[model samples]
Target: MSSIKNILYFQAGLGVLANMFLLLFYIFIILGHRTKPTDLISCQLTFVHIIMVLTGGDILFTDLFELLNIENDFRCKTIFYISRVMRGLSICTTCLLSVFQAVTISPSTSLLAKFKQKLKKYKVYVFLCIWSFNLSFSTNRIFYVGGFTNVSETNHMRVTKSCSLLPMNYIIRGLIFTISTSRDVFLVGVMLTTSAYMVITMFRYQRQCKYLYSISHLREPPEKRATQTILLLVSFFVIMYWLDFIISFTSDMLWMYDPVILTFQKFMMYAYPTITPLVQITSDNRIIIMLKNLKANHHQGLF
Candidate 1:
């Protein structure tokens, strides 16, 4: 257990570091070249990563400070409430990224193209709405999450591993379950649909160009290339998301009873958050351009 906990903490620290670096990179880009609507979404996404990785189970760093016992209802409520808020925010942000990219890549002749033209100017408003909805949606958790302080015969207050939760009345419990399921289903569906649309658009563009230019090789534009990279990252997120869901769904029936599976599940859940920054930086055209220029300058100096 000590070994597992140690590893978790270590990975969490690394994830936090990665998120910080990505956040800085996003800031650099936001202030520099990539000021499009898509970049705005990217910046928002980066902020989500920084906040969630710092505070969420993705780092497990916060676990060290989780000393709430049965008597600390306020502590329990606030901690879990914050966690839920951040997690939900991350989900919304990622879905927004997918939608933004899809809109950005739509052809000028397409119906959605008008919105794409205006999206850049109004992206801040969209971001504000996203933040508002997620924060409001998550406020209910404050009432649902509770911790207990066990006062023993020795008059010692001890913290238990599991805190008490709200009474699962049919209406409240059903709504929570339905809401969580709907959120996941809706977000993932949008991401997948948009990503597929992007892929198809690329195929069609290449096909048309091939016939028009009699060219065997079709080069992807930087926009398409970057969007594809983002799609790949979204694919990675999707995979990890489902794995975590499956493990969580079966945890009590299977995984939770086994330390190995539980540890693996925890790692799986955190893997995307930990690796996401690296993926983003590598996928970012601005970062890639800067690296290429640096290498060229180094080579020229040598000559």
Candidate 2:
């Protein structure tokens, strides 16, 4: 149990640090003159991941609230609500990233090309809608989550050491579940569709390359590399999301949280957010260049 707690702490800490760096890098790029449309989407994704990690029922919020001696109802509700909102935002942002990248890499003659110019202009409105939807979608959580008060209570579903999901009316629960599941399914479907489209686009691009250049001489183009990165991210996220969903579903059905199972679930829940920023940072050439410049500047300053 201690070991699992340690792992959770490590996951949250590492995720927070990596995401913070990625967020700063994106901010720098967006503020610069050479920003791409995809950069804004990626930046929002990084920011969402950071909040997900912090509000995650891991080391940060739990420990801070414990130290500050906050009230149980407020602490649990605030943490759980914010975490859910971030989780929703994470998926929404990822799906948007996949779709935007697909549209971005589409050839001028492709159908997606028609929306390319309008995407940049409407990106802010899209983000606003995503945020508003998630914020309201997760409001039910605030009413149903609170500090675990009774060990014998069969009605509560334990989510964290300090927080548990309290029972609500069956109709209400069913309604919330339906709405939540629908949202997740829709976003995931979009992500998979866009990913498949991107894969097809890449294959065609590669075929074109094969016609023009020797196989041995072929190197991935910048667009191809970026598409590959987003594909990898989408694939990883889907796996993690489904795993977390299964665990949540099972626990809710059983009305009990096994220590081992809960620990694994938490790990799965944190895995994507923790891994996302690292993947983005390593794949992005701009971030790589920035890191190298920072290192060179540090050495020069030392002299």
Candidate 3:
């Protein structure tokens, strides 16, 4: 069982490393070339990805120490707090990204069209808001975590090192869970609705073009590529998130000690990040073109 747990930890570590590399490539190679200023979604996503990578690295280290029976209280507390914050940030970033894409793809005739221009101007502010919101919730984890301590009343357990929460603190935990869950649901709904609307609009546009009958009159709509990209992103987010949610819900019911539950949770959390890069590599033509251009440039420089 311990060996199995170690294998799971290693797999999670690999996933985090893969995500970190892909995110770095996107930032420095892809986004770096854009003439326009970086937007809220881009900046926030990059920061969140970096945090996830670092937090996962810490968790990997902690797991190794546990296997070796090494008790480092400070390291354990730092790991616990950082990992919780990173996981929370991951969910928050995903929610924000979904909403941003949905609004970006909304029809000009729709009420959300006003947001399009504002996003161009207020991108930095939006990112700041996301950071602030996550930071507020994350501070609670720092206080609640503590080092592992054994009490005579109960068997020895590895407690986090830091200020511990009392029974009264359950209220705060409940509030955090409620707020986070509601935010996720709202974002998911927006993504689904926006994607569906885009699909219907595309079909209507195609039908109209077919009826026009003049080849010269037929042109692909300006939003066609953008809509396709957003739809792909939404689909990927929903599938990965649902799997993670299922594993998490089951783990809570079965308890983390259950081998099956622990295995599934580790896979769900770590493996989900790997799918993002694979999706981008397969679907994002812009990224492919950028990579090809870079390679060509390298070869020219060598000559």
Candidate 4:
């Protein structure tokens, strides 16, 4: 189990590094001076990517210290606190992304559509709320996660840093978990529901287009490209997240020590953020055009 956890840390480290580079590229290259909807999403996602990178780095360092049997109390506590905060932020940001995308694609008839007008204007406020919510929820861990002097004999001594959850801590942890889990369920439900609506809407539009085309008319106004992009994102989330959830739940139930399961869980968790920039770049024409222009200029200078 310890070795398995170490392997997970290594994989997460690599994923975080990739995400960090991608985040920088998106901020400096892809989204330069753009105030578009997709650009805003990219910026938010990059912030999450930075948080994940920091969390992954802390996890890697913690594992390394454990491997070397370092017994520093303050270092252990700091790592524990930082890791908890970062992990909480990652999960919260993912839920935020899902909700934001769903609201972005909602039709004028949908209740969430009203927020579209306000989204751009109050984007900073919304983000500040998200940060505050996560920070407040995770603050309890600071008091609970002190380094322990000895590990229980029953469970394997994975790391000497041995921080045990206090009995009272469980209540707070449960509350945080419940809130976070509810948020995840809500976001996933919204994504699934919105995607289904989008598919149905697209189908209806296609039928309308076909009817017009039968009379030698053009196709239906080029179909909303943003809708298609949101659908793709929701699909990716459902597939990756469902698999991770299942593997994690099964592992916990079976008390399994399989490294493969750990690997898959780590991969699913980190891979989404790391590849998000590529997904956005491919799906958004504006970003692609910008990249092309930059490349053209670079080539022109070379010549």
Candidate 5:
């Protein structure tokens, strides 16, 4: 348990740094292209990542205090509520990125092209509506979550306290869980389908180039590199989030007393945000060049 707690502490510190770096990266990108739709989505994603890390850090700190036998109901409720909403928003933004990129690379004669034109016109309104809906759903956490001690555990020789759901009738609890999970399921589907569409479009473009010798001279890749980058980022987020949900679900069902399980749950809380920036930057040639230039300058400074 001690080892796991130390590792979590390390991760929490890294999460803070990771959020800061990604915030800078996205802001820089936006400055370079002040009006691109994809740039706006990237900024939104980075902002959410920062918020996610901060909220997760709150949970880590609260859990630490609980380990020392301190439990605060207000802190627990506030942190959990904010974390869930931020997490949902993060998923929404990633889905938007995938959909937006797919449209950006769609053929002009396709339905996606028409949708893309509408997206440019109404993206601000769409994003705001998403934000409102996420916050509305999170209101349930205020009623459902609270800090509570595990009175069943007499192993007070050394134990930790954690936030738990406020007990409700089985029907209500199940309903809330179902609704929340369904939203996640829908968003995950959007990301996967759009990503696959982008991949197919790329392949089709390649095949077309092969058949038209005259047009082959003017052939371009079906999708932009940035489109693939955003898709990859969404794929990574989906995988990590699905794994986190599975682990959390299993832990809840087993209702085990192990601290390791709890620590791992907390670790998953930070994993996506902490690693997303690294995945995104590596996928972008511009960011890679900037990083290399910075490294060279740093080496020169050492002299």
Candidate 6:
């Protein structure tokens, strides 16, 4: 238990710091008028990850609620609601990122190429719609979650030390479950489809590149590298998302959470968000170049 807690603490802290740094970098680019089409989605995703980490009470220690004298019901409701909304946004943004990248690298004569301009033009509206839908969809959480008052009540599933899910009507619960599951399935389907399309497209593009240039002269384009990174990020998200979903579904169905199992679930849930920023930083040439320039300036000044 102690070792698990320590790992959670380390993961949480590292995730928060990495995400914050990435978020600021995106903001700087936007403010400096050097924003790429993908920057908006990346910025939103990074912000969502930051909130996801903070609301992960298990990771950061929910004891702060007691120290801060927050009302138990309000605290539970706020934390659960925000966490759910951010989780929804995380998937939505990731899916959008994948789709946009797919269109980005499509051949000029291909069907998907037509949407590139429109997607860029309407992306803000798309983001607004996504946010509005998720915010409304997750509102039910405000009513169904509260401070854990009765462990003896078998219907209440304790999610955190202070928060538990209140039992709803069977029909309502089933309805919500079906709807949420369907939404997730649709998004995951889109992600996988885009991923497959990207893979095929990259393979063909590489073949063409090979024909055009000698092996020694061939170099990867920035766009291709970005696509590869998004592919990797999406693949990681899908794996982590399903693992967490299965654990949560089982626990919800049984209306019981084993401490170890719950901890494991939280680990799976946090894994993608924790690793996302690191993947972006390492794969993004812009960030790497900026870092190198800053290091050079520092060294020159010190000398």
Top candidate on TM-score is 6
Report the Cα RMSD per candidate. Answer: 4.6, 1.6, 4.9, 4.9, 4.1, 1.4
Give the Cα lDDT of each candidate: 0.70, 0.87, 0.59, 0.61, 0.75, 0.89
Cα lDDT of model 3 by residue, 167-266, tens digit: 3244775686677678777767866776786687678767767877775776655356645755676687688778766765554333333446545555
Error of 2 at 114 (Å): 0.2
Stretches off by above 4 angstroms in model 3 are: 1-21, 29-40, 61-71, 147-173, 212-226, 250-256, 294-303
Candidate 3 accuracy as TM-score: 0.72
Global CA lDDT computed for model 6? 0.89
- Model 3, residue 285: C-alpha shift (Å): 1.9
In model 5, which regions exceed 4 Å deviation? Answer: 32-36, 57-71, 153-161, 211-223, 253-257, 295-303
Report lDDT (Cα) of residue 179, candidate 6: 94
Please report, as a residue range, the 10-residue window in candidate 5 with the lowest summed lDDT.
151-160
Q: In model 1, what lDDT does residue 290 have?
A: 81
- The most accurate candidate by lDDT is 6
* Candidate 6 lDDT, 1-303, residue by residue in tens: 778778888888899999999999999999999988799999999999998998884445356766788888887888889889999999999999999999999999999999999999999999999999999999987998888767675668888877888888889989999999999999999999999999999999888888888867877788889999999999999998888888889988888888888888888767899999999999999999999999999999999
Ten consecutive residues with minimal summed lDDT in candidate 3? 157-166
Q: Write the per-residue lDDT of candidate 1 for residues 62-85, one digit (tens) a residue.
A: 354553332356555665666667
TM-score of each: 0.81, 0.95, 0.72, 0.70, 0.83, 0.96
- What's the residue-level lDDT of 103 in candidate 6? 95
Error of 3 at 124 (Å): 1.0
